[model samples]
Target: MAYCYTASIFFPSSSSSSSILANDRLPHLAYRPAKIKRRLSFSCAALPFDLSPPPIDHDLLDTMTVAGAKVSEDGVIGTFDNDDEALDAVENGVAVVDLSHYGRIRVSGEDRVQFLHNQSTANFEILHEGQGCDTVFVTPTARTIDIAHAWIMKTAITLVVSPVTRERIIDMLKKYIFFADKVEIQDITQQTSLFVLIGPKSDQIMEALGLADIVEQPYGSHKHYSVNGMPITVGVGNLISEEGYSLLMSPAAAESVWKVLLGHGAIPMGSNAWETLRILQGRPAPDKELTDEYNVLEANLWNAVSLNKGCYKGQETISRLVTYDGIKQRLWGIRVSSPVEPGSTISVNGKKVGKVTSFTTGKRASQPLGLGYIKRKAASEGDSVIIGDDVEGTVVEVPFLARQIPPS
Candidate 1:
């Protein structure tokens, strides 16, 4: 059975003076529609075998036809209300987006910490309750496989992963289990909703929603609290450089949570908006920046790994690379003269030296910024690289935030 309601209500007219609350007196969680609501017949039950329904009200989203780009089978919005507004919200104001489309696994048992510590780039042994850290999973050859956020909680350590590598990571974890190490993996993505709030105003938005203030929390630390009568985990951290927060809640409460955030001035964004921000921030994404083609060293994820930590899978090669400075190509930012396609050849004079990985325009900087891997020999800070015929690009510092660094 599919639930539906009038499209107008979902994107209520800005001028309409009528309140959506039950009576303007009901608590946010207790409010029920005083008027009878209709549920139209529209089935969205069947989806691609490899995909899951986006943990959102597709019926309501479909009615929001004015904004957003293509709708994925999982109902992911490629863009919502134009990239410009989304960019503005994330760069200058508060923005919210559902990341339930990503993959997550719950790992438990006595050996959870040791098991993870052996497999990832980060030292998980130090993780205590309410702490989290960014880590990378590499193959025996030290090639990047996945980058995940490990959340230490009372019941389990939750590993949030990219949907592209969810199955592979699970298989790897299952394959390496020694049978007595005591570890279990459970996919919790379908049952939970992960919403990201970013921009400087993110903390204020959370406060407006009556959630615990996050400005005081240290980065990567998460805390649980009740909001709208729903229990949620709020993680304090940004994608890379800017201020950001992650809200984790049960799927049953997703719609209500989304509605409350939006009502409190949190702008709704989409994947395109997210991709643009990440690329500009020099953050790597699974299957793109995080792939077998590159290693953790080449990806410049220095914070994800610790040299003092002892042996684990692929530790030798990674250690050797660090000590010997064996990295060939490194991720860098490219300032383009014009919009260029991702994966377009980046060349010097006439020879190709690198390839564009991600690109975006209409940004806060009002420049066409991109990120890609450039060979150590060819890339130089502020040196221009050739594109097709007319387009050219100059190497720029990554994390593409204002604090600049010379290209290595």
Candidate 2:
């Protein structure tokens, strides 16, 4: 059993540590935190960005959208036309999403692997050439610095990181350098174009785009190819779904790649569809859900946090939580009758127990689907919750009915 101190801190009642979820029992929770606590109110999404607008035609995107949501601070579209159109694109047609917001960092030098190995949760020492791994860089207290994907190229490691946490990630990674290490970090986000492709036909479409050799490669693995005499980097596996790849190419080649993908049955999807599917798969955007307010375990980032890995920035705190107090709450799926917004309060039997981190209406279903952290005692498979205005939501399994990929 554990007692909630403030929203983010917990103290265990017993010295014997129990596995997070075991013996068909809920972890005992006591002394819930009050709503007056301000620690949980910090939002990374509320921060400012000075990003240049993407090269895509904003006028055309604005005209196409009936309703819109921006994945970034700039005028990026979350959905073009409507959620239904984007949903149809994902399920039936190939969907292409502009991910210019995702930041890219190149870590190079002789000590690059060892340098990253000391900072992230994954074991980068074993990350071979052309291989990749999903990892997290965390604070000394184990709060998420960023959830990132490291693609180990022949001479350097490319870290594709969350948009909202981009600057912080780069700064911290650079700040932690010792004079002895030989790593050099470079931000290449502006020089490169990132596009995510999703659907059952995504692989086939990728093949048609001169990425056939890398289409079936696993997540984090990338291959450099020349398309139209321009260098392109193809990464297989979509972070949002079972089928897809992240295509990275120079800005000069973006238009050509976009046209090729669109011509080969890739439907343009805006931030709305991309976000809806992301929430459906229980993946939280750092801006919407990740902040110092939450830890990796509570964020449902089990895939990114490597408990067995050697010491890293936050290893001490992570090990302590996993072994002792455990997580008091965890991100869970919620189904509501109406659309619920992020920052929405979640109560169990009229007690404020959680907060909505990410939310959206089902594309075709048009009912509400969301992800939020619920107290351990309140987070059972069929538990129910009350959101704003008496709307009721049931705790459902994450991924809300979608194809699942192998955990990273």
Compute each candidate's TM-score over C-alphas: 0.80, 0.78
Per-residue accuracy of model 2 over 1-408 as CA lDDT, tens digit each: 332211121111122222011111001111221111112111111111112323333232333343344443474665556567767877777788878768888888889898898898788887677677778777788776667877887667888887777888889888988899899888888766688888888878754543455656677776554332234566776566536788776554455556566677888887767777888777766766667888776676666666676888888888888788678887788998788888899998889889888888777767578888789887666988998658899988776222223143
Q: How far is candidate 1 from the true structure (C-alpha RMSD, Å)?
A: 8.9
Stretches of candidate 2 off by over 4 Å are 1-79, 400-408
Q: Which residue pairs come into collision in candidate 2? A: 77-271, 78-270, 78-271, 78-272, 79-272
Candidate that scores best on TM-score: 1
Top candidate on lDDT is 1
Give the lDDT of residue 93 in candidate 1.
89
The superposed Cα distance between candidate 1 and the true structure at residue 169, in angstroms, equals 1.1
